[model samples]
Target: MSSSNKQAGSLNEKAGISSPEITNASAISQIKNKRRQQPSAEELISGIISGNRTTLSRAITLIESTNQDHTEKANQVIKGCLSEANKSIRIGITGVPGVGKSTFIEAFGKHLTSLGKKVAVLAVDPSSSLSHGSILGDKTRMEELVKDENAFIRPSASGETLGGVARKTRESIILCEAAGFDVIIIETVGVGQSETAVHSMVDFFLLLKISGAGDELQGIKRGIMEMADAIVINKADGDNIKKANLAKIEFNRALHLFPSKKSTWQPKVTTCSAITKDGISDIWETISQYFELTHETGYFDEKRKEQNQFWMIETINEHLKSDFFNNPKILSQLDETKKAVQNNEISPFAAAQILLDKYKKI
Candidate 1:
């Protein structure tokens, strides 16, 4: 081979085209800025009150965190925002697993935004029992509402909370209200004890249902029926329309059997289709009528006051339980204590007492 040809084919020879820079200093600087320390309570409060969604999300994340420092900071932010909070209506919606909660919420939330209302949805996604993780896929399900500038959709893991809700959901609502959202919607894991927890936090409790093959009133829980401010039969379109109307009548008749509510507002049964968007506006109108009546009768403010008091006691109980379980001595003995009870070496009550005594001493 010619010497020139050998030189051209050399493996170590520099390429005719040069490669671009591997790192961009400007990009690194931007990333560093993004990774800056958490904001102060005052800064978060200011941003939230000014209607910044990013700041509001960060504040909610802090509230959800279990770290000691984060909890303290979250408390400060909540206190600062408390005055601006409680200015919005909180609505709790729940139903059976296949009751189209995500669909109904999207339709309802979009309707609310169209009427010049800022809506925030706190959806509690069920967590995996084995993995203790959640998909948090509500944002994916509500495609349109999520993209709407005026609508905020936040999905949190149920995380061992009895009511299929995040423990910090109440605090998140306060932040959302302070951020100037006119409407706050809480979607629970399903219809169970979670409904009662959600019911206490919300101004109105809505039970979503769909027509089934069996009797409409058969599987309904009496406590849940009594707690409902409104029973909405969703998916009232196509061939299901007639069945939905029949279910509505059955629910209405059942509701009338309950004692009169303190608010003096009769719980109404209505039907709607989330997919076709039919009867969606009417549902809102019914909700509006509820607000008008409750506000005029002073039941709205009174209910909130009662809820606040109830939550105070609940907060104490939660902290006490957390402290009991988290104590160093209790943590060391809990598993062994459980095993002892399981093996019949000790009564469950006795085992629990032993742990409680140890906790008290600690």
Candidate 2:
């Protein structure tokens, strides 16, 4: 028997089902039978709603898979869970490397858990195959919160994608929500414009900053400040308290120079010391106030709906690109087209059109 057929037979036997006859016809029949036995959308939805973490993780893995065969199943699972999703608060936290973002999140998440809120943290680290980066360090930094039963911490690395926003983070958000998490915190490696991707996906964007450095604001860019719903000046205890306060005032003035974000809301600037755990309550209050104002004005729901639509469109575009490049015919011709352009026999634009057209025909 072929290895593939033997594997299939073993799977069927392990499941206490009768093995099919070992033949090509039986092999095709067994494959169809196995596919039919795969969990349906309803089963996945039920598992998620029941707070089965394993099922939740599997669903997210399916969505994150690059395999074209999984796309349809992933979509069905997401659609099934859509009605049960979106009830959780999505907050994005970002800052420069030394801004102590993970420390603040650990402190902040602990405080929320104290208030009886279930928190899930999705921290996206920079991809480093050979090194243990800060995010792995976060597991150690957030030891208290990580040990809490009510809190979940998932650290993902930024792949080829520009933003540290892991390709799986979006789907993971759904899983977290279905598992009854009240607050979903997304932490990104505060690398300037790339962090904007997180801003687009969340309800509130919080920028963390530290004081006492002459280049304090030098690391912060105007574009990032514009995207901030609020800024938390960290390290506000001890001798740095005064410096932190000064930085707050500086940020407040800078924020005022820009027009108000919405008619009912004004961007806020606050200071806190994560190590000392001071001013954390005030930070939470500010976030609550923003949420209330936006929810009352219907902006919160509108924003979430828009974000979902944007993700759907973005995902489709990514899949289209993958499919085009992975086509054997187009890939086979890619080198020839590049050589033609190099030799000036054809323009780069024309070569691109030819490749695209060939894929379209396929």
For candidate 1, the TM-score is 0.92
**For all candidates, what are the clash counts?**
1, 0
Model 1: how far is 322 from its true place, Å?
Answer: 1.3
Q: What is the C-alpha RMSD of each candidate to the true structure, in Å?
A: 7.0, 6.9
Task: Summarize candidate 1's per-residue lDDT along 53-163 as a digit string, tens digits.
Answer: 999999999999887668788999999999999999899999988999999999999999999999999999998889999999999999999999999998999888886
User: Each candidate's TM vs. the true structure?
Assistant: 0.92, 0.83
Q: Residue 38: error of model 1 in Å?
A: 1.4
Q: Give the Å error, residue 46, model 2.
A: 2.7
Show where candidate 2 strays beyond 4 Å: 1-43, 129-137, 339-347
RMSD of 1: 7.0
Instruction: Give Cα-based local distance difference scores for all models.
Output: 0.90, 0.83
Best by TM-score: 1
